[model samples]
Target: MDELFQQADRLSSSHIRDRIVEQLYKQSNQLIKAGVTFSKAQHNERTEKLDAIFTSPIFGFPIMLVMLGTVFYLTIAGANIPSSMLADFFGWVEGYLTVSFNNIGAPDWLHGVLVLGLYRGTSWVISVMLPPMAIFFPVFALLENYGYLPRVAFNMDRLFKTVGAHGKQSLTMAMGFGCNAAAVMSSRIIESPRERMLAILTNNFVPCNGRWGTLIILSSLFMASGFTGGMKSIVTTSVIVGIVIVGIMTTFLVSWLLSKTALKGVPTHYTLELPPYRKPKFFDTVVRSSLNKSLSVLYRAIKVAAPAGILTWVLANIQIGDTSILLYIVNFLDPLGQLIGLDGYILMAFLIGLPANEIVLPILLMGYLSTGSLMDVDGIEDLKQIFLDHGWTWITALNMMLFSLLHYPCGTTLINIYKETKSMKWTFWSFMIPTAIAFLVTFAVAQAALLFGWG
Candidate 1:
């Protein structure tokens, strides 16, 4: 092998590897013809036609988008009932916790911190994070098992290569929709260090499961108005799909910019095998995905939620003159937030919800309620009323969705980026790059809305 490699290096001008492969194929054919008695070739016509459709440049992207949108629609529709059920269960548990604390003669502050703060925070995390993960991951894993995921990467390879990134980045971006932290960790599949870094920096542009939960809620609340039944569902799903498409476009644009500037490099060639389509092992895929991806994400989120819950509780309760510190911070942030088409409470929610994106909606509702406890609202109508009371318009909701899609990665994702890169500089860029894009995009939209008198 060493001698062959040396000879190939010496004949580099002739592209020796191609010559070697050609010669090897020629010899193998000769040997087969001489030794074999008979041979028959078999082909699957269905797979061939499917591949032609899936890999065609004109239709490939649209097909991929449709498939992705279908998956998201199913996950969103499927997770709702379970999410509400879990919330009710947790809420019941909270009632028991409060009574138990009272019976034990726990101090008011301790009870407030333990029950309203830590316990409620963990409950919200579980209720919001689990259902989506459970639904989304297994569906995604089915795609992987069915061998469609690589075709997705194949379809996207040209675009990523044009942006001077590894084609495998497409797979990582897909993983990001399940969880950005998991996606960041999955960047290892890319072989080149520079391209891998590009993948890491750009992964956050794909909204993760946590952000999806918030986006779905806002979409249902704002976009479903004036439409009935099926039309309503269609509009909501389309709006969410539109936001996801924007995130994907942003990923490509930023990847191009970084390739041309900061992470300058030419695209490296790579081979991608289009695996044979096979029957997916449904039970095994679901069990493995739930244990490996869903549960792991839930665990990481719970760890951060507990401490963040306590801190948010403190901020909401600690008095500053007549108002709590939380109110003071919101007031301070309101001006900039408004400039970006979001209010102080929304901005504060994003900041406080940094620990876990699953908690942002809960925290925002808590802020609106002016209660120290994070509580669930009655339904979509009630939530819409609360937003209307706070002067939330279509512009506000749209920009909020945009910002959520483009903003900084959650705490777990940031930590994973740091771990993967082992450099504070890249991790910092990973944070600032998306955040800068988010601010600029929202600011422009807000300005445009104001100019059109849509604000």
Candidate 2:
């Protein structure tokens, strides 16, 4: 068996499988020409031309960048009015709910838990999550259904291979932009154990929907102080795309580091079948994406966040030695947080936000208010004001975005990681790798800003 395997290896060449595949297709074509009478598809030529441009060495990456930036820009801009409207609608409903609770003589804690905790959290998740996701998923789906995603993987395959990972990891990372848990599950596409693990561990570096919302707000701050009108959205999108690039770079770095250290192995090759690009039915694509990806994700987020809101409320209201349980946790973490250019509230938010990233900003706002109420701002203007009141500067905003980008997987994602790997040890490393990197990156930037007096 060993000698036979060695002989096969000696006879084989690089990309031998690809060559065999081509030869088989060529022979099949010959047999078809002799025995079959079917018209050749004209789209094959068209597809070849399209791939030539989309997969070209010169135009491929820039085109991909432009397409990606457009999707995100549309998502950011289109979501604004709808998100605001949803917030307003929810607030109106909350007012009526509050009146009903008061009329029913409900206890304050009961109202807080039911109305403020469960209902508010669920509504907030839907409002904030649904808008951007509604815009992003369908747009992304159009690209996918039209068969552009494979070209993305093709273009990125070499770079990932250079980092000792699979080319298909690019697709998983793209999935991460939607949800890291989904991305972690998507890593199953890469058959190599080492490469799949690399993909899973680094998936969090790609900001998920919740983190994207955080980035959008932070990126807007950069533009809010400067650019206006179209320039503002353009600049904001540019910053976000830049952050996305940063995340990709971090993915490569971590993948390479892990490949060299913990999971050292040779890279494996896999055949990628690029399907013919079909003009997708726009409305159908939108409907399917909305129902499958957007609504489902929103459902999961709300499920996780409602309980988180209850926990936050309980911690905020319950006091020990004149400090709320929430406050004590915040105070304990403040020094460490400050070392990373964040405050206690922001750090504690991330800890509690382990359950769902959707609740992080809300929890932070809750921590900021001494009234022990879960915070919900009316608009970005109000939210920005709250951050400013809390002494957040550009460094703070920058670090907050960075920390959010690099933090550990959300609770659902961590659970998915364990389930997928069925190994608690891998799950533990998946959590640790990102957390350590988040701290290191944020702490270094904070220290450097102080060193240069950026404040």
Candidate 3:
């Protein structure tokens, strides 16, 4: 048996292969220098210099972090006014819709289901979720078009591989910025089954578009409350970036632990190709991202939120004795939710939001107002008032943001996990693992806050 594969062992030595490739590249560079003309040092003179700074030992990760902070800042700060405007327009439209339904002699139940339930939920999703995604995807597309995403993979590769994940998992995590379900599918790029599974399970650690609105609003409303103007936005962005760093660090920890336990395996080598950076056509990139990514995601969110609205309306309106069914459920979950620094309504909203996270805020608002239908706040001030009315402190806001980062993936992502793995056991683990982690992390924070009188 040893003799049969003696030559194969030599072929499979990663060190030898790496050295050979390095020598080949070195020779290729020498030949290019000898043969190529000076006039053709080329337009990528800037590219070489940028790569040196961007990928340097001294500056590489710092640049990456700066870029990340910048993106979050833009997404958080830039989305504000447009989101408020969209909310106003949607509110106006909802009022007109209610009047139209009344003038047409529509039944109260019909109005509740369509106008109050479906329309409100869908509009809230559009107004809140759309602007961030609209701003985020275009800027991300700009970075992607300029060929910087691969550098992200490159910069994070050693860390991931050291933690027993594939380098390309970074790319899938980036894709998770768009959609976790899509990121699950994108994990196909990882050839090793164990590493691929690791990537799939941890993809939710990088908050998706569905979770962004909640984090941004909560951070701005609570974390930056004392500040005003540009200072407020800066503080909000910093908090958001801090939350993102937590998510990323959690990903690394989970990947490491799983690699040392159930998913234990040797890391597989992935050859990363760095492409020449090109100036992206900003307008075209924006148009394509807005139309292709943002609008498409918005449409899917509406489809899910619409049905959620109907269910929530039925639950909130239908009574079991003196209390609505939704309240009863919230009451049942209150003890558990309180243990984690969130209330019953927040828990119920999260459970309902399993289908689509965009609906969580609306359901929470409905639960707060007992409105028999989902609601969208008029502005940040209105939202702040609502949260205050519900006893939301900074601890609550912080815990909620952490849970949003760590909780179970949406239904679509779960189904994709099942389909991708073809193993119900693994899919169940994926759901349970993140859910358990979220509860445990929040419980610790809540307890620590209480012990120190910080709550």
Candidate 4:
């Protein structure tokens, strides 16, 4: 024991420490074979398994993708009904608010801002955000409970190694599903400063729930056009899955770029241990992952989204120089927006939606509806009509999906990057890098469409 301690002290490197631990663990196992206690032997065996899987390159990455896809699928499919119900309830409330305000002779501006602008926006937030999160978080918690998440880290260890990041980034990326800010904070698990910064910088590429909502909505409405009946769901699901794949590819690309440039370093190894799959505690999984995580996210969305709704309503309703502030801003951005295969309103929505990516779709709907004053449309088909009014061709939808796939991190993610790196420079880069990629991709696509006479 003294020699093992001395060996550990003499070797300051992680590699040396790992080797010493390995040898000590092996000797402990041998002692157990010589009639040591069951508990002690089991403990040593567990440590060895942990060391081998975490440090091993094989069987790490495939597991990571599978876990990620499963979490996303659960969130995507589960959120559907709750979102619809929430929207219906909120729309019902909106009708009552209108009647009540009109009955009391409330000022038009105040009614518009509070009820139309503020309340409607909040409704969108609750309806859209609540259900999926309620579904996603608990399922996520279940995964965490069964200790599947650690195995993900174990499986992803090699990819992290090649990219000069800690294998534990798998866990942080998982956290990003809940919220990018939380994921960024989780980067503290990485001991290497450069790798930590790299993880922080590139973390935004993983779409949070807010971004996921936008992707899902866009895919379902626009990209699912080729299919009918039951096939539509499958096609839409495929599109959503494809968007996720793009996000992941983008993450790896950005991470690779960062490692070769500012945050360059050789990747460090990790010792991840896959815990035996435990039968998930059913109710606890629901309470912790599904209910708690969903509600927490919904609570945050309502807080941020309510104010944005009010602001958007105000901008839409207030007339300035024969156009509302919303129109004025959208008009100004139109040409640039058009170049990227989106309208000015879409561009403006993305700008305002910086605070929370989840709000981007709601904001875009607000903008589009404001143009036509279509304040009453509720169904997805109604949304399809609204897009048709705005000249949303299949090409337009494709570009929008592409833009959503590649856009900058939300306001929460930006703050997360700043917090994790503690550097405004890195945060700025994190924002700019993705935005640049989005613009370039969209621009190129639009140009190609025009050149081929597809527009």
Per-model root-mean-square deviation over C-alphas: 5.3, 4.1, 3.9, 5.2
Tell me the tens digit of each residue's lDDT in model 4 across 1-455: 99999977887576675678789878976886798566555565665575465435664455555565666666666667777887888788778989999999998887877877778777777777777777777777887786667766766665676666777777787787678877888889888888887778777777777776777777778787767765666666677767777777777778888888877778876566556655689897797765567777777777887788777877887788788999889889999999988999899888888888777777788888853233767788898888899898878888887887788888877876776677788888888998999999899999999999884
Candidates 2 and 3, the one with greater lDDT: 3
Q: Is candidate 1 or candidate 4 better by lDDT?
A: 1
Query: Model 2: residues >4 Å from true position, as ranges?
Result: 1-41, 374-376
Each model's C-alpha lDDT? Answer: 0.85, 0.87, 0.89, 0.76
Q: After superposition, how far is residue 242 of candidate 3 from its true place, in Å?
A: 1.0
Error in Å for residue 327 of model 4: 1.7
Error of 2 at 33 (Å): 10
Full candidate order by TM-score, most accurate first: 3, 2, 1, 4
In candidate 4, position 405 carries an lDDT of 71
TM-score of each: 0.89, 0.91, 0.94, 0.86
**1-109, model 2: which lDDT tens digit per residue?**
9997887777745356657888998998899778986553578768889999999999999999999999989998998889889989989999999999999999999
**lDDT tens digits, residues 221-332, model 1?**
7877878666666777888888988988898898899899988988776778788788899999999998998998888778877887787888898997899999999999
- lDDT at 100, model 4: 95
Clashes of each: 0, 0, 0, 6
Measured with C-alpha atoms, the lDDT of residue 262 in candidate 4 is 78
